[model samples]
Target: MNTNTTIKDIQIISLPRIEDRRGNLSVIEKEVLPYEMKRVYYLYDVPGGAERGGHSHIDQQEFLIALSGSFEVVLNDGEQETTVSLNIPNKGLLIPKGIWRELKNFSSGAVCLVIASDVYLEEDYIRDFDHFIKSKNS
Candidate 1:
């Protein structure tokens, strides 16, 4: 494995909150966070006891937020790992590059929002766990 450390800001993101009598809204924009606009994705209706995102990106930084419900994200920076649980909509986890991450232990009916620092490049993503390890080492 690479054994290289991924940049992690210990500070949680504080999103802009707008409230009204009917409902409230929180916005996540590229300027709001530290990264520039690249790509955005979301995962929803994740089955119980199921998992997703068992992979890593070589040069991608992302922010993960739970829009609804909750889930656990296991991030391994080639050595020690950190477990980040997502339940709040206004806060997000800054996921640095060159780290292996797996989104597992998903609660029912969860929505995950990811704002990335790069465009959707399949070649940039290490989709397989074994390949990710090998590429990290190389």
Candidate 2:
């Protein structure tokens, strides 16, 4: 793992692999999926320079992977900041709750897979940077 490009101090956990000639299978089910996966979504066909997340979740946890092409996920944990560039299908960055995250610098044809711990809810999101900073400490 690259320290400078780390999203968090928690070493990014790589998903387990199950190889096969027919079709390699990997599961992201429940608590067995490295970190418990509660929700899943994928971002695709993104235009150049378009950003995805510009907010932070109050309690939801997430793990993001580049299923195809490449992109960067910038993370801020109140004080320090880090940027992670993911370009591998099998590799993922686990983002814990309370961290402000923004997804950007997406390469054309990039496909991002996100596994989250909670369903989509507008109320669960902290879209304001000021609120995120305040909530990080609270």
Candidate 3:
């Protein structure tokens, strides 16, 4: 796995939106993302001032989008950290492997959509912050 990745590698991708008189349309293709999406999931009904996603993946990449309300994604690479707000439907955040991420400051009725590069695997997750930092140095 590539453990050399940093917070600098994370990016906010803008999807193509077609506006119309009735409604708007947004599109996402496999070629536009850095990795092919294999799993898709979403988080909803989160209470206000709650948090989620306090772990790092070993070999999986992810893209996070706010489908409804707004939230904040805090990313840390064991050295530096940054926070990004997700409130737009056409915007998504790309998170590479080997970085620690925490989702917080969710508004009421916030819906967070996530796209993963790989399927669910418990072994691929670094749930502990100390272990994640140790793995980054090793």
Task: Report the number of the highest-lDDT candidate.
Answer: 3
* Tens digit of per-residue lDDT, candidate 1, span 1-138: 363755363236778889889998998765786779688899998878888988888777788899998999888765467888889898888877788888987788889999899998888788887777676677
Candidate 2 residue-wise lDDT, 1-138, digit = tens: 011222455346566678999866666556645555667899999888888898877667788889889999889877788888999777788887677788999888899998888888888788988877776666
List the candidate 1 regions with Cα displacement exceeding 4 Å. 1-3, 7-11, 134-138
lDDT of 3 at 83: 98
- Residue range with the least summed lDDT across 10 consecutive positions in model 1: 2-11
Q: Which stretches of candidate 2 lie above 4 Å from their native place? A: 1-10, 19-25, 34-36
Model 3 has an lDDT value of 0.93
Better of 1 and 2 by TM-score: 1
Judge candidate 3 at residue 17 and give its lDDT.
Answer: 97
Q: Estimate each model's TM-score.
A: 0.84, 0.82, 0.97
Sort order, TM-score high to low: 3, 1, 2
Q: Specify the poorest-scoring 10-residue window by lDDT in model 2.
A: 1-10
